[model samples]
Target: MIDNTIFNDKKVAFHTLGCKLNFAETSAIGKQLTDEGFAKVKTGEQADICIINTCSVTDTADHKCRQAINRLNRQHPDAIMIVTGCYAQLKPEEVAAIDGVDLVLGANEKFNVLEYIQKLDGTEKSEIHRSEIKRVREFKPSCSRDDRTRYFLKVQDGCDYFCTYCTIPYARGRSRNATIPETVAMAMQAVEAGAKEIVLSGVNIGDFGKSTGESFFDLVKALDTIPADVRFRISSIEPNLLTDEIITYISTSHRFMPHFHIPLQSGTNEVLQLMKRKYNRELFAHKVELIKSLLPHAFIGVDVIVGVRGETDELFEQSCRFIDSLDISQLHVFTYSERAGTKMLDIEYTVSLNERKRRSNVLHSLSEKKTKAFYQNQVGNTYPVLWESRHNGEFMVGFSSNYVKVERQYDKKLVNTIQIVTLGEWNDDKSALIGV
Candidate 1:
């Protein structure tokens, strides 16, 4: 281990890309460096170390990772540049070939970064430490607070579902997680750090119990026993795994908020089969219907991919119709891009890039309309809102229990505090409701 004194006063800057899970892992890395006596780099100050956590969800994501690496290297010319996460794991050689990267750590080696840093001797080429992702079995628990009051807790890591259109299982490894007690402990730590809301994030959170003998339901029940005033929200879960029992439990629980994020990917069964997804459109609709029936005011966010190799024009139109029929609160639309070394290439059909963009825009408009309706329905109803530390223009913003974005005039006292406020009409742009 490196001596604490040697690391003292060493400032480190972190750049995290992709999911909330990545951010939580970056926070964990920051805490590790802090414990070794490193300070975060302040603005206008050069860092002794620059760590970039990369993503490979899309080709665009990979390009952004490279851009971030180049940008950070330019920003900190002399810093020890470390690159880790999905992009690093999937393309270690490519990442190492980048001009100024000092070290590349894969999924298994990312958390052991301190050991690698101690031996960093400015070698001519970037040092790479990557294990085959399939061999990765250790689950490193992590949690991170956003600028706001919500803290994202990574209850699970990796994925086993290798949907043909996705590279997540390859980049992240098989689905695994820490024990329920350990996850509950991490959540308690976040609460102690003054977290009012904690979100459970992961690659396949519904597949959480694979490593341990416990179930996701068991984990939730244990979390509910915390007896804190904090609320919990589950990140995107597989529709097949989001059972009726779990929905019923959350609908009645005071600790769990009325919010759900489910990935539908494609709404057409033929496209879903081509994508090798576990469930079909009927199952997806059932999950949505169940959530709405149990919790009418819940905020239901759905993930959809606009184009894939097998999605034909008819399939896409069918997808749009099915998605439009759903009573979801919003849609997180992602335009598809081909990735290397995936089963998706076996399929022949392809959506044009222009068509992909048009489809994404169509879904975005639908999302806005649904979100507006959801927000409009909340007007005149008082809900507990956890105000954040930041402000947007003249208004301070907060999210209601059901994830309604509410804005009120900036008040210092409201920061990091919970208050019940009735939602007012939307602003001129319809971005958010004015709260009182």
Candidate 2:
């Protein structure tokens, strides 16, 4: 039997590499460790245990994970190393083969991490406890307390829509979520903890009510009723699932911010069909139009994947043109990468790496132009900016309700406070709106 004295006065340091959902999970893991009599190591401080929560969305993410493991191995070789999250869930054997991983856990196993760690003996071989993704059905609700200004509440988990170029469903399992009452309680807890904003994150948040009988709209509506000054934002939702009711409710709700991030993988119907995306170009365009019509000052962001399988030059041009015609504030362009066991790998044609980068550049340039125009349009408007704790040399930055980046002279009292400020002319060189 392992001795429990090993954990006495232990310190743990955590590093996460991925999306907001990953951050929420990592924060939850940190809370678990802290509650178990472990101290959280401050920045630049060494610890007895190191946890690396990893991502596996693309080949780049996997490469970065390996590099991180090697770097951490050098920094804390003797520290009890734990690797978990999407990358570990999908490839536990591969992660266990890393140089310093002592324990590797999957989606279902991560929450039970303390139990698994107590049984480990600091051997060369990694003790992996990853269950199959198909078997992970229960939703273990998590909320990030890493920052006092904002909270990432994971109201939903997993995805059922196995997109052709995606491995999320395989890494995170099927769609599941907490009941409405449970979600409201979580939000209230965050508010009680002094959070100014709450960002809802999930693998497929629009499919929230699949396992539970609660809809996304119902959950948000209940959240709006919570007696807190915190605002709400949806990280990203599928175009098909962003119903008109949700849009209308957000427009009327005082607590819901005027921002929507909807994923429109491709404007070409053929490419979208190959990606197994439910919404077509027309549907996506209609959704954007509806948001613009209802909330004129709303910030509409689109997520687009360029150079997917079978994306010829003609189709790419069509996509560019389609995006250019939309009234979006910005675009998140992702260059497609081949993932093993994904439907895209078995597809007939493949876009070259050079072609993918070229397409990505084109979309990035377009996004810049759209963002500049959006900022310019808001020059004379007044917005309530939620200032964060981050600061440059002389200026502190914040984001408005519609996701506009605003900057002002550094002031200690302004951090974490929402102040109504009028936007002045854009400073093109800095790419920020001047706050008056």
Best candidate (score: TM-score)? 1
Local accuracy of candidate 1 as per-residue lDDT tens digits, 1-436:
4667878899999999999999999999999999999999999999999999999999999999999999999999999999999999999999999989999999999998888999888677899999999899999999999867789999999888888888888889999999998999999999999998999999999988989998999999999989688999999999999989999999999889999999998999998898888999999889889998999999999999998988888888999999989999999999999988889898888889999999999999999989888888888988899899888668888988999998889998888888989989997677889888
Which residue pairs come into collision in candidate 1?
Answer: none
- lDDT for position 238 in model 2: 94
By summed lDDT, the worst window of 10 consecutive residues in model 1 runs over 1-10
> Which stretches in model 1 have alpha-carbon errors above 4 Å?
none
What does candidate 2's lDDT look like per residue over 221-315, in tens digits? 88888887899999899988999989988989889999999999898998999998888999999999999999998999999999888898999
C-alpha root-mean-square deviation, each candidate:
1.0, 1.6
TM-score of each predicted structure versus truth: 0.98, 0.97
In model 2, the runs with Cα more than 4 Å from the true position are 1-6, 146-148
TM-score of 2: 0.97
